[model samples]
Target: MGIFPGFGGWINQNIQQPLKTSKRSKNGKSSSVSEEDRYIQGPWYWDPDISPKEKAESMEIDHVKSMPLSATDPRYYDLDELVRQNRLWNSEKKHPWNGAPAKVKVKTKKGLCHLNIDFTLGSPPQSVSEMFTNPRNLMYFHSMGKYKYNWRTRLDTRATKVLKKDGPRQITEVEKVLRWKILGYNGTIPIHLIIDENHQKVTATYKKVKVKHMKVFEGSWKIQPLYVDQERLCKSRSRISEEQYKKCSGGKGRIGSKVTMEHIFEPSSLLNVPPVSWFIRGIAVKVTKALLQDLREYVITYNKTETVDPLVYAKIKESIQKEKETELKELED
Candidate 1:
């Protein structure tokens, strides 16, 4: 009847932890704590430095220009491979996951782009529209374009009931309608949907729809482990009375180990989805220690240099030679 309520309660789902930035004490001592020992609560939203608009723009530009993530970096090739892998994961039909499309509108400092898609009318209620129109969603796509969408119902509920009786499949048909959003150059677009039964269509043109690439950091999720904190709880007392010594004998020597809590989850997983939500539901859970170890192997393979796998080194050398040849030929011309 209303928008879905916020999730509540503690979810003890096991997930992997992303790399965290933490500062050491002035003495420059390494934390004796293992990351796994930390516990954190969730509904963890992935926070990238740039706004979603910026991400969309970057992706659009990269795609439209057929450019790699980093043009100036040699590792761009490898990074491109990674990006391909990321997109492949999203587009796979077996996975009900969709990587956010980077929508961009390129103009001559003053142009527009239009997009058109049909909607099924009466399939969504007013509450769904309200959710789509939420401020957060609006701002997320504001730079891409303004939405001018409408839905026309093809059949009433009563008529649909009659149609279901006659059809062997007994499936009710939703109204077909077209939905569209329009945006100026460098505008953000909101991704909202409406239903229309009478399939109508609309068209939109933009100066550029290809923006920039989404910056996906190397993400890992794992179960947080218990940790012992060693910070001193209070100043050391001199000449403890026998009674006092007995009272705190077991708790001696600069903050004994204490339990730590941390939160970890899949990088691409949605924050709003409930814990234990299946990976097929677009929330990645169930990452295990073994998966992390395997991923580590891949990362290590990518990192090694002077002594790389012979085949890999040979391929790299061949690529280098070809690149050099191409450069020389261009220079001669």
Candidate 2:
């Protein structure tokens, strides 16, 4: 399905308004119409000529709540419950130093610190990896208006190369360099991120990306299998066949994936102050949550549309099947 069904009609109704061109009067003066007003469509003046009962019904229909029509729509989310759960999870899983979801461990000898955060995503590792590695998708996640205030953000992929690969379960390494910049930023932040895919895990790592705000910035995103109980799996479904549940349960339970993001960075002197650290941490949490939420929504939207790449989807399906087979083998052993 299209991201928004009936989007053409929506554009006609809400965006593509017909404009009335401005005209100068014979008296060498423009009419009362302002420049901005001339570009705006005039207010609706057509008489509906409908019955009072019909008008009341129309009003009622306009006020009636409807299911989400698109991934970007606000009605698609349970905002209060999601926020509450995310906050509670972050609070309960905080590191000792700061009350953030990421653990901070200082390496006194090396004069550096590591920030580690782990969470579970709803999708499989292949889909997550594909989304994260794509330059366009990365921009969508990072340049979210609510989370990022900067404008004119751009992401350019400099190069991509496959280094080496073994079997499906063996290590497959790929490297990519990206140039990123935002409006008002002095210079571009060039990132060299490496992606490692294996049977058991997929990881993306970047070491030291120099930016104006930080002396050091490095991070890794890793995904690995996670198992959940049958009861939990059943909560996601209304009904399940006994045999089907047993097969999917794989003796232990249904399989999911745990995603971890780790970063180590030293801020520039301007933002290295004590108070600024707290503010930065707050922003980091908000942005991270927003990124995850957007990723989930984007994946759902992509799956519904016909624009998905067949080759990539095939690889993802194969990887998932392999994972299931591996899990079954492990159970047998």
The candidate that achieves the highest lDDT relative to the unseen native structure? 2
Cα misplacement distance, residue 256 of candidate 2 (Å): 4.1
Cα deviation at 19, candidate 1, in Å, is 44
Q: Report the Cα lDDT for residue 172, model 1.
A: 18
The TM-score values for the models, in the order shown, are 0.15, 0.42
Candidate 1 RMSD computed on C-alpha atoms after optimal superposition onto the true structure: 29.2
* RMSD (Cα, Å) of model 2: 18.4
> How many steric overlaps are in each model, in order?
57, 0
What C-alpha lDDT do the candidate models reach, one value each? 0.22, 0.40
Residue-wise C-alpha lDDT for candidate 1, range 1-333, written one tens digit per residue: 010111111111212223232323456553533332121111111111224564455434312112111101111123222222223222333322211212222111111111111112110121112112121111111111123132211111110011111111111111111122223222221111121111011111111111111111111111111111112222344544323432453432111111111212222233323442332112111112222222223222222324332222333454567789999999999
TM-score of 2: 0.42
